[model samples]
Structures are given as structure tokens and as C-alpha cells.
Target: MKAAVLRAVGAPLTVEEVDLSGPGPNEVLIRVVASGVCHSDLHVMEGVLPYPLPTVLGHEAAGVVEDVGPGVSALRRGAHVVVAVVPSCGRCRLCLRGRPNLCTAIRGRPGVMADGTRRLRLPGGEEVNHFTMISSFAQFAVVHEAAAVPVREDIPLERACLLGCGLLTGWGAAVNRARVAPGSSCVVLGCGGVGLGIVQGCAVRQAEPIVAVDLWPQRLEVAARLGATHTLLAGQEDVPALVRQLTGGGADYVFDAVGSPQTAALALSCLGRGGTAVLVGVGQRDASLSVPITATVLNERAVLGCDYGSAWPQRDIALLADMYAAGRLKLDELVDRTYPLEGVNEALADLKEGRALRPVILPWGDS
Candidate 1:
């Protein structure tokens, strides 16, 4: 199978015909249809997040199940599914408590079945690691059955791919983590794909006076079209002050989708008394965010981190799918452009330019 391999940090990806193994027990082999170029992948490429090099870098994806391994009963061949980055051990304490996204037992290892062996091999017979436990960048991927969520047949594979990451992260932050109530005021920092999802999520729940913030005017425009009741330029000297003014003091909930200390701090400040601030973005490894301990105590502000929108694949995927089917969640408009696998660099360039909402990579035939 041909895949875009990240051979080194700060280097261009090379296309290579790699060898992929068949599925093992509890694993599913998927024929990759489409994958989204996410910022996390770029982070890995640029060394923002440290990981093994020569790994296939893609997590947000959707495809058709070509085969399922022994003991995999929930899925069948030819079934349409979206691959999740967070592979849960189902019996873990977090998964048992209804928080599968927090399950970390399956991470930090090479891409192998639970037996600890490599699945994909290079042409020279060397083992190549998979990224995010999904590695949807390749022509085919071997993912755990728990990581593959079955989606409706009617939904386009490209749109369903977004739900695996950006959509779930944004929507889950609003509905699950922050639990923003209807008729409440909220502010979403950064109007990128995830931020836009947060905006739509807030709107779907009827969160009144949704404030969208971003430096780019185009994203602000898209955010308004999606669900933002109000848009902020994000060019002001003090964003927190602007947010407070827009919501008449402060918002009931604030979301930081950019994941930087600056944006996280701003989101924390945009919250009203007793309001909650959810940080959904992953910051740099050495980066740390500081907050006023006195101010947090005085105003009773709560700051929290949201992982994968706290999504439970089996249930949340279906929930978002139903929302998309019912027109409550907008997926088609979220796509900015599509690129062939060979044009992955162009797609990443578009992403860095802040010119794309969600750039999807159509592996082969879709292009």
C-alpha cells in the first residue's frame, strides 16, 4: 500500500509503497477513503510534538471496512466507518466510567496488535510506525475495533472523516465538557474547524449570543454563517475585555480551540463569575499557562482541559451523525478544499495560510 511517510522532522513527506499486515483479533482493516490534514499532523512534522519519525501521519479519517479480525463482532465487511485517534481498552477505569477519550493505556507504543509487533513494513523489511494508533494516511490501516465507529451509509466519507477529530473535539467540548445550557451566553476562541464546530454546537443547543473570535475575517464570516450570533475581530489589544463587553460583563462559558497559552488565558478571562472555561487545544510540550490564583478564587472561575471532546465513539459518533443527518450539525460547509494524497503538501500549506476550513486528502480514486 502506498503511504505518505514522514521520514524526518521538518522534512517533506515521501510517497512509498509500504507493506501492511492483515488484522488480528479485535482489529479491523480499513480501505482508506479520505483523511483530513490536521494541525496535529503538522505538529508532528515540525517537531512541535515529539514522536518517532518515519511514521504515517494521519488520524482524522473515514473508510470502508474491508475485513475484521477474530473477536471483532460489532463491525462487518463493507461497513462504512470513521476512525478514532483515541484507542480505548474498553475495560479501563476511564472507559468503565464512561470516559473513553481519557483512556491512555493503548498509546505510546508502536503500531502492533496488543502482542507488541509491527503491522506495516517498509519495502526493505523495516518496521514503520503508525501515528495516533490510527495512521489513516496510508492506503489501508489496521485499527482497533474500538477505534472504528460505524457511521451511516448516507453520509459522505469526506464529511464523516471530520467527525473523527475536529468535529468531535469542538462539538463535544460544548455539549459534554462545558455542558453549555440553552439561552446561555458563550464565547469560542479561534474560528478554525474546531472552533466553528464549537459555534455550531452552541447554536444547536440554542446557546444564545454566541461570540466567535479569530484574527482571520474569513473564518469569522464562516462562523457567523454556521451559528455565531456575534463575531469578534480578535485584533483588539485586550480580547478578554472585548469578550466581556460583547456578553455584558462575561460569558457563561468560554472555549479555547486554539490551544495556546495566550488563547487559553483569554478564554479563561472571558468567563463570567462561576463560568467554566474549557481548553480543547493541545499546547506545546514545554509550554505552560499561568492564571491569577486570586482572581480565580474571587470570581469562582473554573478552568478545564477537554480531550477529544470527551467523546465516546459508539454513542457520540452516532449522536453527531444524527445531528448531521437532521441538519442541526453542518458538515458540508466545514470542508474548505480537497487534495489528492500526492498533493498533501499543498493542503498543509493551505492549512498554515489559514485559508482552509478543513482540507481533506482523497487517497487515490476520490481525486
Candidate 2:
């Protein structure tokens, strides 16, 4: 199978004829229809988040089941599915307690299955590493059955790919993690793909006075089109003050989707008393968030970290699919460009330009 493999850090991914393994017990082999080029994948490629070399680097994807493993009963051949990066061991404590996102089985590092073994290989007998436990860059991916959530047949594969990551991360941040109630106010920092989804989620919740802040005017414009009631372009002015002014003296919830310390501080400052600040971006490894100790205690402000929008794949994927089916989620507009696996660099270049919202990768043939 042909895949975009990262041979070295800070280097371009090369298209190579890599060897892929067939499904093992409880695993499913998927013919990847489309994969989203995510910022997290860029981070992996840039060595911001360190991973083993010669790895296939896509995580946000949707495909059809080509084959099922011996013990996998939840999925069938030709079933459409979205790949979830976080795998939940169903019998684990966290999974049993209804928090599958925090399932401890695969916590802290990249490993596959209960035995901590990888499934990918190279043509010359070398083992290839998987990224984010999904590795959807390849034409065929062998993933645990739990990681593949079955979706409806009608949803477009490219749009469904967004639901695997950006959509789930942003929508879950607003609806589930932040719990933005109706009539509440929200300030979303960064109007990129995930930020726009957050804005839409707030709108779907009937949250009033949505404020979106971004340095890019185009993104801010898209934010307004999606759901934001107000847009603030970050120029020389203070963002927190603008958020406060727009929300009538402070927002009930402020989300930092940019993930830098500066944006985190802005989100913290824009919050009203007893308000929550959600950090949705993955910050740099060495960066530290400095918060005023006195102010946090005095105002009763809560700072939260959201991982994959705090979503349970089974429940949230279905809900997002339903929302997409109902025309509530903006999956179609979120797609900026589509590229084949060979055009990975072009897709990524467009992603860094700040013009395109989200770029998807379409694998060729084999389905």
C-alpha cells in the first residue's frame, strides 16, 4: 500500500510503497477514503510532539471496512466508519466509569492493543510506527474495532473525516466539556477549523453573544458566518478587553483554541467571575502557562484542559453524524481543499497559509 511516511523530523513526508498488516483479533482493516491533515499531525512531523521515525502521520480519517478480524463483532465488511485516535479498552476502569476518553490503557505514550505491539511494517522487513494510534495516512489501516466508529452510509467520506478530529474537538469542547448553556456568553480564541466548530457548537446550544477572536480577518469572517455573533480581529488592541466589551463585561466561558500561553492568558482574562476557561490547543512542550494565583482564587475561575473534546467516540460520533445529517454542523464549508496521499506536502502547505480552513487527503483505489 502507498502511504506518506515521515522518514525524518522537520522533513517532508515521502510517498512510499509501504507494507501493511492484515487485521488481527479484535481489529479491523479499513480502506481509508479520506483523511484530514490536522495541526497535530504537523506537530508530529515537526518534532514538537516526538514519535518514532518512519511513521504514517494521519489521525483524522473516515473509511469503509475492508475486512474484519476474528474476534471483532461490532463492525461488518463494507461498513462506513470514522477512526477515533483514542482507543478505549472496554473493560478498563475509566471505560467502565463512562470516561472512555481517559482510558488508562493507552495513556502517556503510543502503543497498540493490550500487548503494546505495533501493526505496521516496511517493505524491507522494518516495523513502521503508528501515529496517534490511528495512522490513517496509509491506503489501508488496521485498527482496533473500538477505534473505528460506524457511521451512516450517506455522509460524504471527506466530511465524515472532519468528525474524527476537528469537529469532535471543537463541538465537544463547547457542548460537552465547557457545557455552554443557552443564553450564556462565550469567547473563542482562534477561528481556525476547530475554533469555527466551537463557535457553531455555542450557537447550536443557543448560547448568546458569541465572541470570536483571531488575527486573521478571513477566519473571523468565517466565524461570523458559522455562528459567532461578534468577531474581534487581534491587532494592536487588547483581546480580553474586546471580549469583555462584546460579552457585556465578561464572557461566561472563554476557550483558547490557539494553545499558546498568550492566548491562554487572554482566555483567562476574558472570563467573568465563576466562569470557566477551556484550553483546547496543544501547547509547545517547553511553554508554561502563568496564571495569577490571587486572581484565580478570588474570582472562582476554573481552568480546564480538553482532550479530543472530552468525547466518547461511540456517543459523540453518532451525535455529530446526526448533527451533520440535520444541517446543523458545518462540515462541508470547513473543508478547504482535498489532496491525494501523493499531494501531502501541497495540502500541508495550503494548511499553513491561513487561508484554507481544513484540507483532506483522499487515498487512491483499493476500496
Per-prediction TM-score to the true structure, in the order listed: 0.96, 0.96
**For residues 1-367, could you state the per-residue lDDT of candidate 2 as single tens digits?**
8999998998999989888776877789999999998888888877888888878999998999999989899899999999987878878888888778888775325634444677777888888887776788879888878889999998898899988888889988998898899999998998887898899889999999998888888888889889898888887668788777777778899988889888888888898888899999885877778888888899888999998888899899988898899987888888877888888988877777785789889988323
Candidate 1 local lDDT, 183-209, one digit each (tens): 989999988878988998899889989
Structure candidate 2, residue pairs in collision: none
Deviation of model 2 at 354, angstroms: 1.2
Minimum summed lDDT over a 10-residue window in model 2 is located at 106-115
RMSD of 1: 1.5
